[model samples]
Target: MLEIVPIRSDSRARARVKVRPPAFLGEPEPDTSVGQEISKAGVGIILCAGALIGLGGFLFFIGGLLTSGGITGFVKGWLTAFTGI
Candidate 1:
């Protein structure tokens, strides 16, 4: 035999009374030293810029033989046009 139970009418009766602690206690505080943050950011930017410049330079050297606009291109153009050699 199956018995059907009556549902509770009060919404407060179903509410939870126990509270759980947060995984993280509170908001993280920002770094107060502006100069240090700026210096670190600047160093990162400089390193990235230097790496990009070096990569471009290497690619220019490698592909210069096929084009007349790269570093080798300008040199070849100058020697052929100006020196007539």
Candidate 2:
């Protein structure tokens, strides 16, 4: 097995260790565009879900308003409102 190791410049038995930058300062930050695009897509999904929920609630309310319990009276009210009679 070939093991790759950094060659030390100092030949002393106890060589000076090279210090690496901290992890926080490690590699250059990844492309931020990818994250931004994901966030944009997430916002779109959230807005779409909200719109669908609102539409569903509206449909439920309309359905309840049209059920047989008082549908005839409700239609008469609309007819009166539209014809002014």
All models: lDDT?
A: 0.74, 0.76
Which candidate gets the maximum TM-score versus the true structure? 2
Global CA lDDT computed for model 2: 0.76
Give the per-residue lDDT of model 2 (tens digit) for 2-85.
Answer: 999998888668568887654464243444466776787899999999999999999976876677357787677678889998
Q: Candidate 1: what lDDT?
A: 0.74
Give the per-residue lDDT of model 1 (tens digit) for 1-69. Answer: 999998877746456687645445433235336777678789999999999999999887667655766
TM-score of each: 0.41, 0.43
Residue pairs in candidate 2 whose N, alpha carbon or C atoms collide under 3 angstroms: none
Residue 19 in model 1: lDDT: 61
- Backbone clashes in model 2: 0
